[model samples]
Target chain A: MIKLKANGRERVWFYAFLSPWIIGFLAFTIVPMLTSVYYSFYKIHVFNMNVVEPTFVGFKNFKYIFEDRLFLKSIGNTFTYAIIRVPVGIIVSLLVAVLLNRKMPGTKLFRTLIYLPAMIPIVGSTIVWRQLFSNDFSLLNFLIGNIGLGPVKWSSYDNAMGSVLLMSIWCGIGPSMIILLAALQNVPVSQMEAAELDGANAVQKFFHIVVPMLSPTLFYLLITGIIGALQAYAEMSLLQMPGDSTTTMTMVVVQNMYRMDGYGIGYSSAMSWFIFFVVGLITVVFFRVTNKFVYYEG
Target chain B: MLKTENKQKRALPLVRTKKTRKLIGDIVCFAVALILSCILIIPFLWMLICSVQPESSLIFMNPPVWPDPIRLVNYKEVFFEIEMPLLFKNTMIIVVSNMVIGIAASISVAYAFARNRTREKNIFFSVLLATMMLPWVVTLVPQYIIYNKINWLGTMLPLIAPSIGGSAFFIFMFRQFLMAIPKDLDEAALIDGCGRLGILIRILLPQCMPIIATMIIFSFNGSWSDYVGPSIYLTDPDQYTLSIGLSKYLVANSVTPWHRVMAGCVLFSLPMIVVIFTCQKAFTRGIVASGLKV
Candidate 1:
């Protein structure tokens, strides 16, 4: 870090340049964070415009959340969704990236086609997915029928979460593939050549060289992916899968706060804070455990 | 040269077989790529096909691969009956306002972080990056409360006002782009009596057009398609953005025409498709740049 002795004018200009972010940080992030924490310990009731009050509840919300079956079920659903989605998403993306990184014909066109899904808005794409997975008239069921398989009820209570995972993986694979592809391109060609000269097979070379080299990017993706999956709401909302066995934790938060007439604001705040803690803890554990495996090529 | 030639002669068959192996690998890769591309493209193609097909044809067990006669009535209905023009106008207002405010705020702060070399600045930058990992859920309820208290609920202010504060990701992108620029240019401008703001506006901004364009495109895409923010804040039908409007249209009337819904989806996604195609290089470069930084 280079230390520069700035004059009074430059110092003033420096703060001026940073004022917007500072103001935003305070007004948006820090205040909201603190307020959420504070509100979690109280019963916040808002009646119309002028009547609003927050009474101290002191751990009742958290206690209620722990005992709440819906909260527990949502947490379970969210975990199930994340556990299925994240690993499958990573593997699929890595496979696609590897395929695209190869010197193949029409690689650019193929890359663009695969990535185009990520560019579409989630709301619109979810609607398209609902149509595609509709049991009665679905294109998927039609193809499956041609192959002599039974029509799958994709949006049923048993399969709703699975359908959500499938759509998410499809929509999400593009960005992850782009990241992994970029990482794969950065693997030094000379190292691969050296590995080849040592009588290593293609699989051996990929596992020993490419996977390790790509681990840092994979690690980054894993953390972000887990966080994203845990906090997923838009897809669930757009897909209209709410308050069932498939209600995710984030959906529960939204449902309790917004859809439930704002009566459970404190309880919802507690739920949100609980998710924050879990996500934060998972992220920390990931960095601690995976740091050794991530290769930082200098 | 003679010894090398002799070695090469011995290695010729090995190289030939290696070439064959590589050829097989490329073929396999191409096959896989083709399958994956088809999987990705089929949904959008289905949307397009369904949007033009009449409602009677959509109820079959096996959907048609192509629209017969290709009626444009769905789009016409979406425009006239669905009030899509109002949604578009509402969306554009929020998108354009957020883009302008967000870019200005992000660039200035990013410029500050890029040019300054102080311990406190580094700490602030790291805090900003840390905030990126803080899920939006953590702030959702509290922010809603704040907005409700201020009576900005059911208004665009709640959706648009928060953006005036720089977004962490955009700020990071701008900072990274600016850091790649050399400091000597700033020094030269300073010696020529250029002020700090002038150096940013006159020198850095021109060179950083690609990143600025990237920011604009991303902000536009994000604000245009944003559902959660508007859904939470805006309650009035008249104030609904395209995303909310389309979603409500779909959810409110399940028995409504699927063709019209598909038409609305296409219209909602059309601008982004055009932006992606037209600014393909910048778009990919921006994504790749962010990915590489990770």
Candidate 2:
């Protein structure tokens, strides 16, 4: 990556030009990131004078996180949510992209329609989703009941996460599909024709040619999607059934941010680290597993 | 086989089957795509419908597909129930601040990386891209504490101040776009005694309308729809953006006045819809471009 050809004047100009990003990055990204890591290991008490006196207790906060039922439960719920939602969302998006990639009528309109919901603010849509998913008052159950099915309790404990999962998938399908559609456009038409001439059907052609060709885009979506899913906050916060039923890993940390008591600072920081590590681990594993099969173009 | 082949030549039969298969495949795909798109878009449709429904008919035990009486008064009622102008004024403050400052900073940094040739620049560029993947949760707490420490809480500073540094995504985007521009212009600008900033401003920027529009749309929608930052920092109701206001509006009320809140919700996302559709090409390009970096 070295390109050390610029003269001293260019060096000065480079520094001059990048001052805003450098300062902002150091202030916003670097300092807080390190401070949070520091906070995670210590019991930080904020006193009246804006003085933070932290008492170091190495791994105690993390220990407490492992033992805390709420934390464990929240982590479990997050894993379960993402484990289901990520793959389903990806496959659904890929299928939609593949289908839409075919020459069909009104394909243009369908693309826009699918993508419109993704543009709506999650906070606003969650409000609408909450009201719409209420068991008796829901449009979903009402539509189902009209189709000769029993009204599913969308807000019940067993189904609350399911409803959010459904919504998450719904909101997610657009962007991923859009990405996959673009990637599909890049798939070699000659390769597709070769497979077709060899007597490959649509399903076989999709599984063999298209999936591998689109794997890099799919992997990108997977990592980002999982990262996003793990950071699920606003929707889980606002849309959960009226209780602590749907605390995600984010809420595990965020709940403490609201508490007036002081112990929460360290705990919240520790939980965030836990989320951070989980995200890193998942990214590594995904990259390793996908590296064997995914295609990357120059 | 012989009888069927007799109806048409063997070659003709093969072509018919192939054509029929493709026709069936297209039909099936059309149906599935239509259905999936409908399912995906139904909630926003419901929200739009609810915005016009009367208070009692917003969500129905037996929804009749359309609201009865279509009380467009709900739109006006939104203002009386909540401080619409104050919320909009507040939200637009963050959006415009982030848009103007964020775009400028990102473009400058991008230009620095694009034009500069240094090992450090290369390393910093990679770091910037990596930061794009770093989930905000890792920094959420310390940043909050920092904001609290700096007394930036209860104001829009926490929401607004971060953008002055530039965003990684936009910087990467601007850098990618800037790198694609031929260097002959920069060389000519240099020969003509244009300053570094002068070159970027005069020679490069006007050609970057698409990425700028993309950033503007993203920044506007991002800050406008943002609830988390404002929820964390802005404690005062007087400073609430519409998104935070919408989230709190439900809890702060008895039944949530769904019709009116739906009106608020519609207004909340109306600007986003307009911005996205108007700049549909850039919007999709941003998404596709950002996603393909892997």
Per-residue lDDT of model 2, residues B218-283, tens digit only: 677677778778888888888888888877877787666767777888888777767645653432
Q: Judge candidate 2 at residue A115 and give its lDDT.
A: 73
Query: lDDT tens string, model 2, A1-298?
Result: 1434446667889999899998998878888878777877888775541327778899998898777777667777877887898899998888887877777678767877887676666545765677667766677776678779968888787788887788778777876675566556546566687898998987899889888767756766676677677667655655656564543334433544423355566767777777777776776687578757756443
Q: Which candidate is the best by DockQ?
A: 2
Q: Which lDDT value does model 2 have at B111? A: 93
Residue B158 of model 1, lDDT score: 81
Clashes of each: 0, 0
Q: Distance (Å) between predicted and true CA of B37, model 2?
A: 2.2
Candidate 1 local lDDT, A157-270, one digit each (tens): 787777778878888886677556645644656668899899899899989998887776677677667767877776676566535544444534453443245566677777
